[model samples]
Each structure stands twice: as C-alpha cells, then as structure tokens.
Target: MYGQGMSLRFGVLGLLAEEPLHGYEVKTRFEEMLGGTWKVNIGSVYQVLQRLERDGLVEATGDRGDRGRQAYRATVAGISGLTEWLEDPDSQPQLLREDFYVRLLLLGRQPNGHLARLLDRQRRVYLQRMRDLADQEKIARERGRPQVALLFKGGQLHTEAELKFLDAVVDEMGKE
Candidate 1:
C-alpha cells in the first residue's frame, strides 16, 4: 500500500532536492510551500525521515542545527526516485482514485441520488477554491516567490477546469 506515507516520503524527497533540512524545517517548509493547504505533523515527518534514511534515499549530513536536530540531504538514489516519480503518469490515478473517483462511485450508488445536485455543489466548492488560490497567488507574487505563485496559479487553473467538468456533468445528468 503506497498510501499516505508514500506521498509524504516523495514530498520530503522533493523538498530535499532543493536543499538539506531537518525534520522540523521540512514540516514548516512544506506547509509554507503548499500555502497551508497541506499541514504536516512533525511526528509523521520524523517517521518518514527515518524510513527514508533507512532506505538510503537520504543521508544524515552529520550536521546539527542550532536546535541540535540532524540535517538530511537527498542521496543520488533519492534524486533518481524523485525523477521517476515526476515522470510517471500512473501516479495520476492514485491521486484521482482517492478523492474525486471515490466520491463519484459512492455518490452514484444512492437509489434516489441527485448526481446533478452533487455536481453543482462540487462546482461551488471548486469555484471557492479557485478564488482562494488566486488570492494566495497574489500574496506569493508580492512576496517575490515566483515559483510558489506559479504553483498557486496552476492550482487555480486546475480548479477552473474542474468547474467546467462539473458543468458538463450537470448538463449530462439533466438530459437523463
């Protein structure tokens, strides 16, 4: 099961690809990078770090921070893993299956279900998310973080796309 931990492991590796960091720095940076949409727990970060170290994906640099926490950097193996993950199109299914696809399946099972109504509500949520992302992007740009701003803009675009999809679904269900 490549479950929750796998996602976090990859996220950690991706962060390490930029620079070395301790567990706490990883957690804080991840939260900041995602604009707080994904909040990571320190304990889980430590657990993933230990597993990454054990797997030789990352190595302790024998460097200690002001707080005395050990810093870790991604190894060659970790960089290779990150590259493969980035290039894999198969990972899309794992992402969609857990959220949108599962919701779609379970929502369809109701005997008297109004799928159109479900879709409409989802569209509203996505629209709100898009607005939020836009605001975040503005802040990122003002802070001179072009990379983070680009990420937020991408999320806004994707949410806009989802709204279009929901509209199509609503229209199709109306024809049923």
Candidate 2:
C-alpha cells in the first residue's frame, strides 16, 4: 500500500490481481519485491485492503488461514481500476510539492535562515543517495537484472536532476 500523497494505489491492486493474499502476506511480499529500498508497513497494507474492500475493488475470500486471518482478492472492478490507472501515464501534480520543496519555501521565508548551510547539508545527503543508488545499479547489472537496473537508472536520473536543481537554486540564492 502507498503512503500519504503517494500514487501507488495501483501497486497494491496489481499484486492482488495476481492472487489473493492476507494483509501480512501483502506486506511481506511488497517489502520483498522492493528489496531494502522501501518498507511497507503492515498497518498501512491492512488499511488499504480495508479501503479497497469498501470501494468494491477487493473482497474477502471468506477463506481464513490457520490463524484465522482472512484473505482478500481483487474483484473485476479492481482489475479495471488497475488497468485504467496503469494506462493513465500523467504524473500526479500533488507529488510535485514534496517535503523538500516545502522545506525550501519555508527557509526562504525566514530572513535569518541559514540557507547555504541547509543547501550544503541537503547536497551531501543527495550525493550519498546517488552513491548508494549507483552501487545498487552496479549490483543489479552484475546479477543480470535488466528491469532492476532500469529502475535504478530512473532513480539515478531523478537524483541527478535534483542535484542540478539544487545547484541552480544555490546560485540564485548567492546573488540575493
């Protein structure tokens, strides 16, 4: 399941499209699929499953595990929703106002804000992330995982763009 403001509702639905799974199994499998890059909380998964069920996108199979946990599967509406979501390729505008942008905007509003220091710290963090992603990309390539490598490459490009945007901001701030 997706976090607040995250546009990954389709992700949970997509997994359900394959087969039915309980909340715990959904959490485990989602975390496994992403490796260590992301952590999907069990609570969030359950909440999303509940919401899906309420929306008629999924339904309880009435099949329970040995522990009495119920399993859920995608419905026809879920499949249709997933397909429609996947086919619509436009970026969600809400995502553009990420925390980093809010941080920068707030910092700019403060007359005595240590903008340079903040930018320097953020740059270091971004550089470290870029390094980590590069390492992952190399490992994925060595393991002959083209799909994984492609995902990493996309992340790398995004980080690179962020770095460039940061530099431009720093330059403009220097002139002020």
Q: Top model by TM-score, which number?
A: 2
lDDT of 2 by residue, 1-176 (tens): 22344344567778888999888888877765664477877788888898889999999999999999999999999999888877765654454677888888888888885777778899998899899899998988898877777778888899999899999998898898
**Residue pairs clashing, model 2:** none
- The positional error of residue 162 in candidate 1, measured at the CA in angstroms, is 1.5
Summarize candidate 1's per-residue lDDT along 1-176 as a digit string, tens digits: 24344667898999998899999999998888777778898999999999999999999989999999999999999999888877765533444644775777777777676665677678778888988999999999999989889989989888887877777766776787
Model 1 RMSD, rounded to 1 decimal = 3.1
Instruction: Report clash pairs, candidate 1.
Output: none
TM-score of each: 0.78, 0.85
Clashes of each: 0, 0
